[model samples]
Target chain A: MKLISVKLSPLNSKKNKLKFSVTVTLKKDVLDPQGKVVQNTLKNLGMHDLKNIRQGKFFEIEINEKDEKLAQEKVNEMCKKLLVNLIIEDYKINILK
Target chain B: MRSSVIVFPGSNCDRDIAVALQKMQFKNKMVWHKETALPKSDLIIIPGGFSYGDYLRSGAIAGKSLIIEEVVKAAKFGSLVLGICNGFQILTETGLLKGTLLRNKNLKFINKDVHIKVINNTTKFTSKYKLNQILKLNIAHNEGNFFTDNDHLKELNNDNLIAFKYSDEKGNTSNLSNPNGALDNIAGIFNDKKNILGMMPHPERMVDNLISNKDGVNLFSSLLG
Candidate 1:
């Protein structure tokens, strides 16, 4: 038996819950035209304190299992299949027991 | 009602949509891309295919076609238009639909059976179903991700233009199960007046219970009504 805990972020609140905090960020080479526009807006808004604001998604997931290794595998599979878009996004996993 | 499926040079799924419409008893016409005008019809379908080999961007190259001009006119004249897969991409390219179809989050060709939640059943394309109902359909594409601005999304939602949303097998419309990471898991949508509809899923491929599920047949049937 194993147990797993996952947390998703509120960055993309459209389909995600407001509470879970999982961080999914865009890859380095991917173009972020939207982020650039928002950055320009911030500068105009006098929030001159902001810099290099790249955009990405954050997610938090909770797993109920008995085997730690198996649970990790499941979570990783989910990330590969659905969560983290490997082509343009890179993801990091944080697990809690 | 007679129907026509506009066939671009690189469109692969044109035949499937044609077949589906044929099964529904609509006289289907295969209109070529160069045709200046669409044959008379109550509905026009821009089936999915890699127009112009997805050259510059998914639908960027196909947006300049002369046929698109007529299609736009037909839609404006109140003809029903349905775009599927690459057809959806083309709709965005032509500005008939809102938002853009970006590369898949994973950047791989994904093919699988996915669940879709009917969001707006008031449109002719989806009026056969109830809201929040789940239907299993097949999805195959590499550039199906949908993107839109926050203000535009809010306006779309408030205007009741959002048609269908992606969901899980249990019929949950959560962002977590968005296979292509679409905004609001929006599998399909209608125009402001509800005549034009575009979706990334292949409803044409789901017409037969022997080969695939028949969940999508109702969409065409509703159009007939």
Candidate 2:
């Protein structure tokens, strides 16, 4: 039983998948009209303490790589190439596991 | 002139641009988005439509389509590329043109005939129009407000790359004349090389005198010349 458990532990580490979450939001200078409308509606509904609201998109990606550094690099490439528009938006990537 | 119009999924104005191109005596072909190669053409048009149903922002999916690679290659080879309306959105997404089209300031989809003044008529796309000519064109869009960084705005102005500006009938480009709150009343702009143009108005919609006026005819004619 000790021998089998040791074998399984190596396999589990070898097949470990990396999970990442990316948050994309409009740049500081860019105007988010949709967020403004939502904030106005919330204020009208009695949420008077809300000062501002900025809308954005969130994406969760699971990469099939075992190396954490490589998985993070891949996610950054995906964000730069497709997931986020660098011109008008900024993105932050966080490792989930 | 040999022309190609890229047709992506959910493209509604593919046939409209094809008709206008054919009327202008252009040998036009409708290229599907999944195709990898573009037909041999001098002008490549990305027509207006809600590509991928405007998912993940307008034109975001369509900008990364298979055919866009070929379009980018062709543009690099100095082919004239025109992107109208949602096509304009795709161009910005692909980074072929600077700036992005944000949601309308009023947060409403505006559809109406607006006046646009020809800002620069030296390019092949606007050679037929007189300088500062006011043209009535159809604009229907929810995200037509053009925005860019301050540095790029200065570059566009300094290089005289502005193609058209929203203006009054008398050609007054003022805040009141601005339709969608575009920066500096900009309706259309050219790349630094003057080979690429992206605009929000639908010139193809105004080419027919029977259905609409002939204000857009000069644009096609200029290309033919």
Candidate achieving the largest TM-score: 2
lDDT of each: 0.80, 0.94
Best by DockQ: 2
lDDT of 2 at B50: 94
Q: What is the TM-score (0 to 1) of candidate 1? A: 0.71
Per-residue accuracy of model 1 over B1-225 as CA lDDT, tens digit each:
999888888999988888888899998899998999789989989888889898745766676688889999999999999999988888877878877776676656789999898888888898888888888889999888887767768988999888888888777877778987777788887877789998998988889999988998988898888
Query: What tens digits encode model 2's per-residue C-alpha lDDT throughout B2-102?
Result: 99999988889999999999989999999999999999999999999899999988999999999999999899999999999999999999999999999
Give the DockQ of candidate 1: 0.02
Q: Write the per-residue lDDT of candidate 2 for residues A12-96, one digit (tens) a residue.
A: 8656788999999999888898899999999999999999999999999988898889999999999998888888999999998
Clashes of each: 22, 0
Q: Evaluate residue B222 in candidate 1 and report its C-alpha lDDT on the 0 to 100 scale.
A: 89
Quote each prediction's TM-score.
0.71, 0.95
